[model samples]
Target: MRTDYPYDLAISDLREFLARRVTHSNVLSEFQEELDSSLKRKTVPMRFIFEKFIKYTNEHKQFVPYTKDEEDMIDDLFHFWG
Candidate 1:
């Protein structure tokens, strides 16, 4: 498969290849299940995602849920003032 080709089919083929690499075997079926599950729910906020990541990285240290933009503003103010 020439991945550089243009078409909806090309994108589909690329997705199939990535799924094969990520899931190992049963690529199509496993991703179909994941896609179905994702379609069934709303996406979580980045703050929530960061909190979970911080917990994992910090070995259960509690995370304050601050969004990225808010954190950036705080950093900017502190950088200029302190």
Candidate 2:
């Protein structure tokens, strides 16, 4: 009998996927810190600050490359219970 495993998957593809997930997680964690600081200071609204930060950081290719929809989803998740 043959197993239905993904034997054709390349190691490089797995590495790339892991790297992307890690980078995305790191960016979101960093954003959480910024959000907390901003909230404590009462400087601006959380959503506004998050949107501005995402817009500015996303311009550079070196940073996390979240699409507009992904950013919106992340924003919603972060604020959902907070």
Candidate 3:
């Protein structure tokens, strides 16, 4: 079925619009806390830290999550910054 809005363009626009809305300070603080905990445990895995950051951001809506269809494109463009 045909739709009024263009799907690809809409996803792109939404991603761009939300990019500026993300709160960097909250992300940074969460990352720092994770890093400190990892350091104390003496098992500092960069991947783990990043994964936790992504999960935290997604959960807290610091950066809003995208829909499934938008996942690939958004990930390619922003490396899942959300």
Candidate 4:
């Protein structure tokens, strides 16, 4: 699917983040699930979706929580939209 500016950047950031941490298929699946959920919010900005995604992965424990530096790598990409 075609993606615009910061949304595309956010997806890149997410894919990169998952690339580091995903050791199994289920993790990738869960990431997709969260991404889809965030994407469904047509009214919300990408930055908020990105933040919620980070929170879900951090809190849900299906995937490992991000380290501070790891969070830094992915978190700011969507802020470019604002």
Candidate achieving the largest lDDT: 4
Report lDDT (Cα) of residue 68, candidate 1.
67
Q: Name model 1 segments beyond 4 Å from true.
A: 1-25, 44-82
Measured on C-alpha atoms, candidate 1 has an lDDT of 0.39
Q: What local distance difference test score does each model get?
A: 0.39, 0.44, 0.49, 0.57
Off by over 4 Å in 2: 1-23, 45-82
Q: State which candidate has the highest TM-score.
A: 4
| Ten-residue stretch with the least lDDT total in model 1 | 1-10
TM-score of each: 0.23, 0.30, 0.33, 0.42
lDDT of 1 by residue, 1-82 (tens): 1223233332343344335334334534645454444335522123432343344536635344656654563343233322
* Model 3: per-residue Cα lDDT over 37-72, one tens digit each: 654664433455446656766777676556765565
Who is ahead in lDDT, 1 or 2? 2
Instruction: Tell me the tens digit of each residue's lDDT in model 4 across 1-82.
Output: 2234445456656666766665567757766666666556522255554565567567665566669866564445434444
- Tell me the tens digit of each residue's lDDT in model 2 across 1-82: 1122121222222233334543556655655565556546643243554464556456644475666755554444344412
TM-score of 3: 0.33
- The C-alpha local distance difference test score for the whole of candidate 2 amounts to 0.44
